[model samples]
Target chain A: MRLPSCGCCAIAVRCRFWESRIDMPLIEVDNLSKTFRVPEREGGFLAAIRSVFNRRFRQVHAVRGVSFCVEPGEIVGFLGPNGAGKTTTLKMLSGLLHPTSGTATVLGDVPWRRHSEYLRRISMLMGQRSQLQWDLPALDSFMVHAAVYNIPKDQYRQRLDKLVEMLELGPVLKKQIRTLSLGERMKCEICVSLLHGPEVLFLDEPTIGVDITMQARIRDFIGDYNRRYGATIILTSHYMADVTALCKRVIVIDQGRILFDGQLEALSEKLAPFKVIAIDLDADTDGYDFAALGDVLAKEDRKVKLRVPKGAAASVTGRLLRELPVLDLTIEDPPIEDVIGRAFGGSSGVGPEEETSAAESQGGDR
Target chain B: MTAVARSFFAFLRKGIAVMLQYRGEIVLWAIWGLVNPAVSYALWSAAAESNADGTIAGFGRGEFAAYFFAMMIVGHLTQAWDTYEIGHLVRSGEMSPKLLRPILPIWEALAGNLSYKITTLAFVVPMWCLFAWLVRPTFDTSAWQLGLGLIAIVLGAVLNFVLNYVFALVAFWTPKLDAMGELYFGACMLWGGRFAPLDALPDILRWLSGLQPFKWMFAFPSELIMGRITDPSEAFRGLGIQLAWIAVSIVGFRALWSVAVKRYTAVSG
Candidate 1:
């Protein structure tokens, strides 16, 4: 039996595509699925050769019935825990992979068809791979792109000069690609990718391996580029700062499905956002049995901590102070990463401060 | 017409600039260029020296040297390794930016191959001349033969480009295409007269090899240069076959490219 086709389906409401709750999303996907057959192997050299002839195949579904949408010029972050099919979805959108079943349309274009006009409108940068030739200087690579993109010589020069200045690629342009550092190479790659001034920028961890300063620089440049060109940006990174700094809306996927897709602040509130409110009481206070209020996180000689829903934080904190002994109280936001970690069946001790640096580095891994 | 040529040459200039930066690797590649063909020539020359009748098939020692040396030069000039390259580009999603451009990807690949060939030809020319002088074959160098040789070489280059590109598109389907690449080179080495002339093979093998485009790439050209295929009828058939293969390859490439692109989605799920 054939699987049902559900095109770019998502539960998120008031999306950029939905102006009056009746408008369709600029990008839509429905019941999208992709499965791959990987060979099952046995040890031994002879067996390896035998397997090559009589291969054993196992089907692994990378994306299963997942969907979402973005409006023109809206910067959206495609987020997910590791191996949650973020890259798989991005590849499908970029026309790099065929969906096994379902539908995906970007600005009304079926990406896999590789329509010439559609191709000319978008560009993708997968962090681990570079488009520039390894034997060439960045200038030479840029020149090749200028011709391929059919950029006028005059316009090419102006855009190149601006990119060089913004990316600080002057020191690296003349150097062979092999001689350039990782950060330097990434800068050149970005410059090369942008030569055509593409309208839709699909950046998959374009900042991976770059230094913190370089990461921030790239993010700023991305913002500036998007503002100047009004290009739609779809970025995927493990770094929360990337989403917080650049994207107002985020779609978080887990196990090849959309676990949460909405505004970043709204998602935070929807998930467990209230930090464990810990109160240290006077030494004279009797043993506080506060298990009924919420999940008790910890207890010390004079301190008691409680984990509660974001909506109940104010009332619970007020009640605790009014009804029981309380000396000091502190409230904070729970780390999104930690909350996501638990939500995805991953138990961890990720503090809130670590999210920024972790997310910043994630900028490099698409 | 003016717009296309202008754009092509602009990209070609960029291709040359890119190749210039690999000067260090160029030296290493030159060393490989000398060593690989030299070994093949030496081994076959040794084999020919052991011929019981002093002539194995139609090739004597002198003729073998002349033919192999010419084949080596032609092979170096016409070779393309971009198939493996395209695979990497697809897997890593680097093909994205290239596709984003106005020009087709094949044109860029062709320009890249040309840039590499012209740079590396410096080494091929010297090596060819050095080997030719060592294995001297007393021969006439008439203007007709020289002109025909020039034409044949140009035809050989075109044939090689078509063959390589047509197979390179296979990378779109076959991820690990090293075996296919080796098979292609092996065919050229054995039947194309890159190792020894097809005439030197058994009569049956010679007949079959003559039917191959590989023969047009090397054996046919070497024979024309030597003024062997002087009969107008035979020369016409040889040249015509080369053109036919070019036509076939062009059509084949157009069809294969569309099919191959259908399979490429840009990334592994």
Candidate 2:
């Protein structure tokens, strides 16, 4: 069999072909699982000493039977709380960790096999890890990355210039990475990872630890990269805004199991089957009961907020308008944060039965 | 250039640049490399001087000086610390980034080893000359011996690096490997003839040293350069042993690396 050429033209041609196949999935993962054998011992001098002689280990199933397909040029968000196997799944897909069982293929190659061609075509950006040389200037690290990926000189220069301009990294290019701010360092990390124009990007918390503005800026850059290069991206982040902004589809995982997978708006509609209605009453009716209409979320002097079932939102609004002297009213879906919080069974104060009843009620009303 | 060569040179350039940033630290490390051979020379020379015939195991004070001086240079050239470093890289999760690259991480590490040696040469060369002048060691080296010895040193460096890297693969299984590094260093000291010449050792130790590859790494090159091995066939045999070890080490590295990466937990992200 002939080996593929590692060149810009080859990558461009392959990317265009993959991009043209809109229906074909660029990445396919099937029943993928990773179990880590971690040594455990109680915290104490005696336990530590005893454990040295009689070591005990427990299996931690970081990722359990995770299976997802990502099409070309799509950005899919991997949502979860800490230790939810978000990073673990990304690691396995990026060829950094071997899955204990199951299989994954990215761009027609098994990822864990780690063929040089497969590695050259993909990039993984770990927000907490620094791939650059700490004491050297960011530009130096970029040059090294270019060489490591075997990028042609002209193409390397052109891409470097484009990335520098897009990332606004001209000023910080010559500065040592250690001296740069956390946001600046992250930008440099992104810059180096993209120097090869990888077709697949596994970004684990790409916007983590940055300020709000920086996070948004990084998100924009990532979106722009995906649009321009037709790259397939899998991103994991704790910030709901990141998911809401970049990803139309999200996979919510918890405790090594995928809880939900669908459109972002659909997640809210399915998981949090309620609409928040805020009303500016014209007059304060002290004798009126708001709970009869829906769940009273807030009752201030003039303004009142009600959490009405999605199916009954219109009826509740009509009743409130007829009974109360309302000045203005607006209905909106619950925040993504709240929806995800409820998905994880967090402190959202809503029980599983309420969620089930809400779904049933919405279905029946529809 | 080919992709591998270009990547190697790039890593070498970055390694050299990083080393240049710590001039004082590099000089200190270079001096530390010298101190071991110097102390060994002193102890052995004193022992030779106290002998009835001013000789022990056919080596007088001057012969001991020559042996140690050559050993110092040989040791410096053959130095590798992956055994000490791999554990830290594994524990701190620094190896993950390197593993992501298309090339093997060992290329970058080899670049780092060469860069350190290159950067420290300026400080160490002058110190070596000073040591030679102070010790006034004698030399019986021929042109052919010197040429073959230089070739041996290069082979010895390759052998040492590959073997040490293969051993360092243990870090993937057990991340805390400082004791392993110490054991490796101790073995090299005893068997590689760094602490004392192999012939001067007791019969059991001398016999044991010949059984391992460390003798080919440090002892053979040092003895060859000092013109102690007069037989051409013996010198060739030593080179053959070094080549065999190099091949074994490369195979061992490939075998261990395939398994080690699978075992990597990638601890901290």
Q: Give the number of the best model, judged by lDDT.
A: 2
- Name the runs in model 2 displaced over 4 angstroms: A1-23, A272-338, A344-366
Q: TM-score winner among the candidates?
A: 2
Residue A255, candidate 1: alpha-carbon lDDT:
56
Q: Roughly what TM-score does model 1 have, to 2 decimal places?
A: 0.79
lDDT of model 2 at position A346: 66
- Candidate 2 similarity to native, TM-score: 0.86
DockQ per candidate: 0.40, 0.56
Docking class of 1: acceptable
Q: TM-score of the second chain in each model? A: 0.89, 0.98
* Per-residue C-alpha lDDT of model 1 across residues B58-108, encoded as one tens digit per residue: 566666666666666666666666655776776666776566455567777
lDDT of 1 by residue, A1-366 (tens): 122133233332344544534444556676678887777888999989999889999987788776556777889887776777888888888776778998887867898777767766788888877777787677877876776567888999999999999998888998989899888898898898888888888898888888888888888888889888898999988776677788888877655666666678766665556666888886655655688788887776777878887778899899988987678898765555556766544423544234323333322121
